[model samples]
Target: MKLFSLKKTFFLIIVLLGLTATSFAISNDALRQQLKLFSETLSYINANYIEVPDQKELIYGAIQGMLSSLDPHSAFMKPETYQDFQTDTRGEFGGLGIQIAVRDRVLTIIAPIEDTPAYEAGLKAGDRIIRVEGETTEGMSVMDAIKVLRGEPGTDVTITIWREGLNVGKDFTITRDIIKVNSVRSKRYGDIGYIRISNFNENTSRELRNELDKLEKKPIQGVVLDLRNNPGGLLSQAIEVASAFIEPGKLIVYTEGRTATRNELSARRFDDKDRDYPMVVLVNQGSASASEIVSGALQDYQRAIVMGTTTFGKASVQTVIPLSDGSGMRLTTAEYFTPKGRAIQDVGIVPDIKVRSGKVVSDESSMDRVSPSAVPEHLMSDSEELDSDNGAPEDDLQLLRALDVLKALNAFGGTYSRN
Candidate 1:
């Protein structure tokens, strides 16, 4: 059986060499030489190694090395890891509830989901995860780190984090839980509508539509769409959210790859004209991917004014393809651009009006002091914690600026073209 396996492997290599000769520009002779060298190395390792090694593991490692050389986002996942990847889109998973990415070859926190153990523990965006359970995460992939960070509910793991302002890494011990993301929330600021999208998930579109339905019942002149600290999720949900405001069949985002010329995605939902009130979109350094798509598309169309700090700037599109062994690979096939051809890869969407982070304080000494209690319980900010929630302060500086601009737009009674 073992001899047969070795023969089959060499046979597969020969087939690959033949395919490579026809597909690639490299000379067939040189390519054949390289394949021969690889086969010899594998054959030697299998025969002369002190102990027998798992052939499956050896193959998986080779695939991972190849993909890792391409980009940080492209990775080879094992069967179990691929299963977890599917669960992520549903927005219900057992873990710390933080979106992470490998930026500059370091495991960086994109954003901590609200109402999760990680967010409540005060994990902020741009924080680097240095260690997990006392094990250094120095050379760990994002998927490996995720496996260690997640476990059965009620269990706990300690992660050491390093942030920009911190002198040294800090350790945080948080319990695992089934994080069910309530991606959309809303509030009313008098005549203005406030829709806060924490992240784009499968539930986001349905929830956002419901929120929009509720807001439409009221006479809202404008809306403040808050997307601060929102590490974006499913791309489909991003288009759906944009379609709530942008009319049908208009370009929302376009992607281009080496082999592919252009693939354009457009707003599809109808009845967007009714929600075409003057709008202000709120974003910050934590808002990325799908978040950038919606914000950039709106800005390009002049449909809304974006306010607050710049976005997190993740514009690469990852395509997950399954392999024969139930494992898979997430390959970075293309980079995405906004409708007006603005690239968002490392260059995040710049807000039309930049507002510094601050608290909005009315005349505290005046008799008209609006205390925290004065604000209705239902009208409270969507921030999980006051420290990390850039969009929600007692009275948010960015939110106030957005409302002020929307109010101004309402006063001007301007009419803009729809998709």
Candidate 2:
């Protein structure tokens, strides 16, 4: 933080900002008066306060308050938090490994990264984290929630969450670990390929390219590109990953804001791999940002049948600005659009085939009689992992639905038509 005269600190800061009411066309004198009022308020507080307040904290608090008023996504990060933010994009962190957002002033889980403590604990998307380590998260900022959830690896933090089916909130104890993600994982189901993209990190596009290449060698009939629970990362990776399926010279995703220029990005690579086969892109509420870009592009071109629930719909682009004090602030700069010029801000991409996730228990199975949420935390347990092969088989209804659609497309010679 740069030094400012104590009495005229707010006044000088405002003048340095040179902010004007552009839309309203308020005069320079009016703006100065507003700045003067701010300085006066601060001066009054400082002169008559019970104790000498830390001037640095006062400035930082002011910045945070201003950012918070802008939007849920924009936030002022302290130096340590800014450092952690940089580490997260590189795909490794000492944290709980969950993507979160603030919705309606409540802390909500976007998705838990695969193979992490949160995922292993069975924390699902749309789960409202009411408390973290007994601290109420009712109005906590996403950055603050992150600070609490992340710490030295091997430390434990218990969170209380409320889900749809549960009558009351449930507590889940999760141990923080070094979250190192291998973004792309694949399984071969006959002539069809099932690829689960857990999260899009620095290496997502490279990982995906290698996986697609390996699968193309076998010449699969169709492919299931799963983006369910993938809280997206790196816009560059989104474009690169989408390039694998979308044709070169075709628009993948674009962004525009009031002040920012419209960034029109298109696919660049096509010859290295053959991608004419039928595809089923699986998405859910957990699918956000980069995941939206991929699925939206594929759907817009009619290249794939999108299945599962609607996406998380985080279309706004945040530009992280580093401050002089090693701190930083993420400011919302733009809103992204799909190839078909669809604005996906609050309204997410809708799937062609809507399939909710659940297992179809046969009538003969005695366990079919059990209720979904018998107890608060009865939804899932360590022994009853939802995605694990070792646990009691949980049929992926969405995957099955996508496969059925894929087979239909295959039978019709890799072509699909919507009625």
Highest-lDDT candidate: 1
Instruction: List TM-score per model, in order.
Output: 0.87, 0.87
Give the per-residue Cα lDDT of candidate 2 at 50. 79
> Backbone clash tally for model 1?
0
Error of 2 at 361 (Å): 2.7
| Poorly placed runs, candidate 2 (over 4 Å) | 1-5, 8-33, 364-394
- For candidate 2, write residues 8-87 as lDDT tens digits: 66565556545544445666797768767766767776777777667778878878988999989999999988987888
Query: Superposing all C-alpha atoms, what RMSD in Å does each candidate have to the true structure?
Result: 5.9, 8.0
- For 24-123, candidate 1 gives per-residue lDDT tens digits of 7667576678767877877787777888767788788978888988888899999999888888878788999999988888899989999999999999
- Identify the candidate with maximal TM-score: 2
Off by over 4 Å in 1: 1-33, 361-395, 412-419
Worst lDDT 10-window in candidate 1: 382-391
The CA lDDT of each predicted structure is 0.85, 0.83
lDDT of 2 at 296: 95
